[model samples]
Target: MRIRSVVDVKTSLGESPVWDVEQQRLYWVDSMDGRVFRAAADGTGLETWDVRRKIGSLALTANGDGAVVALDDGLYRFDFAADRVELLAAPEKDVPSNRLNDGKADSRGRFVVGSMDTLEASPSGRLYRLDPDGSLHVLDDGITCSNGPCWSPDESTFYFADTWTGDIWAYDYDIATGNATNRRVFATVDTADGGACDGMTVDADGFLWQAHVYGGKIHRYAPDGTLDRTLDMPVRKVTSVMFGGVDLDVLFVTSMARPPLPRFPEDGPQRGALFAVDGLGVHGLPAHRFGA
Candidate 1:
C-alpha cells in the first residue's frame, strides 16, 4: 500500500475523521484547538470553523446543511451557512470533570457518543445516544477515555474503545430503538503493540481497522476479533481512521502534534498531519449522516 500525508495543516490533538461521500469532503477536529476542518478528498479547498470549546467529534447532517458536533459538555448543531452553533443536549452537565469524546452516527441516524475524564484518571466517563427526536439516553458507564465508536456493516454490532483501559468493546445493537446492550470485551490493545486504541472503522468486508496511537500502526481485525494484519504509519500519534475517495477505496488517517508523552516520547516529523492510504484492495461502507 502507498501512504502519504494529505494536508499541510497540523493539529495539537487531532482526533476524529469523518468522510462525506456526497460532498467528496473530509471533516475532522483538533480536539485541543476546538477547531473543525473540511477539505476535498485530496486536501484542496480547505475550510475551517472554530467552536471556541473543545470539540470531540462531528457528523454530517442528512440534508448536508450543517453538522451535529460533540463539543465539550454537550452536543450542538452547527449551521455552515448561518455560522451558528446551537446546543442540543448536555447530558453530563452535572459532571464537570467529563467531556464528550468520540462519536458516530448509526444507520438509523442516531448519534452515539462517549465521554472521557479530563485527567484520564477516573471512570467517570459514560456512553450516550442522541436520537433524532432531540432526546438523549445513557448507554454505558465507567469509562475513563472514550474513542473508536462505530458499527458493523449489518448494524447488528457496535464497537467502542476506552483508551485509558486499553480495551475495545462490542455490544449488541438494536437498530430500531438505537440501544446498545450485551456489552463484552471484543479486543484489547497490547501495550507492546500500541499505547492504546484510539479510533476505528469497519471495512466493506467486515474487517475492523484500528489506529494504534503510540505504536504508529493501523491494525485490521477480523469479524471474530482476531488480528488480520498491521500497516505501519510514519507518525507515532496516529489518532483516528476513515475511508474516503472517489470510489471510497482510500483510507484517511488523523494524528496528533502535541508534546510527547513520557511513556512514548518519539514521533515522526509529520506528526499531527492527515494521511491517506491507497491501493489496499479494500473499500468502506458509506458513512451515516445524522438525522438521515
Candidate 2:
C-alpha cells in the first residue's frame, strides 16, 4: 500500500484516529497537546477543538450528537454545537499520576478505557468499562502504559496492548456482560524496528492492524497471531490508525513528533503528520458508540 501524508499539521502525540462515516470525516487526538481534530476524508477543511486537557482518546455518542472523551483526568461528553464538555465519570480521579490513555466503545455501546502511569514512575495503569448507565467497573490492573484496545469482527475476542511491553494480549470477550477474560498474548512486536505497540483497529475480515510507536511501521496480523503484512511508515512514533471512508477502505494513521524517545525530524519529515493509505483492499468494521 502507498502511504501519503494527508494532514500537514504536526501533532505532539497524535493518536486515536476515528472515522465518522456519516459526516465523511476523520477524528483524532493529539494526546500530549491536549487537543482533538477532524478533517475531511480528502484532508481538506481541517477543524480542531482544544479541550484544555490531555485527550487520550474519544468515541462518538450513539446518536452521533456528541463524543465521550477520555481526558487526562476524567471522562467527558463534548458537544461541538454548544462548545461544551460535561463531566461524565472520573475513573481515576484520585490517582494524580495516572491519566487516561487509549480507549474505544464496545459492540454493545459501552465505553471501555485504560490508564497509564504519567511518568512511568509506577505500574499503576488499569482498564475499566464505562457502562451506558454511567457505571464504572475495573477490568484489569498492573500495567505501566496501556494503548491499543479493539475487538474481533466476530465480537467474541477483545485485544489490548501494553505499549511498554510490546505485547498485544487477547481475552475471551463477553459482549453481553462487558467482561474480558482468558488473557493471552495474541501478537508480539519487536521494538528494535521502531517502538512498542500503540493503537489498533480490526477489519471486517477479523484482521488486526497495529501501529508501532517508535517502530516506524504498522503490522497486520491474522487471528492466530501470524503477521500478514507490514506497512513501513515514515515516522517512528506511529501512534494509531483506523479505517474510514465511504467504503471503510481508507486507512487513516496518526503519528507524533514530540519529546518521546526517538523523536521526530530525526525520524522523517512526516513524523507528526497524519497519513492516508489507499488500495489496501480491505474494509473495517463500524465503530460503536458510548451510549447508543
The candidate that wins on TM-score is: 1
RMSD (Cα, Å) for all candidates, in order, is 1.4, 1.6
Looking at model 2, which ten-residue stretch has the lowest summed lDDT? 259-268
Give residue 121's lDDT in candidate 2 (0 to 100).
51
**Cα lDDT of all candidates, in order?**
0.90, 0.87
State the lDDT of candidate 1 residue by residue for 34-69, as single tens digits: 999999988999999889899999998897589999
- Candidate 1 residues lying further than 4 Å off, grouped into runs, are 259-266
TM-score, one value per model: 0.97, 0.96
Stretches of candidate 2 off by over 4 Å are: 261-266
Cα lDDT of model 2 by residue, 61-159, tens digit = 987468999998999999977778999988788999899989999978899899999885588999999999999999999998888899998889999
Report the Cα lDDT for candidate 2: 0.87
Clash count for candidate 1 is 0
Tell me the TM-score of model 1. 0.97
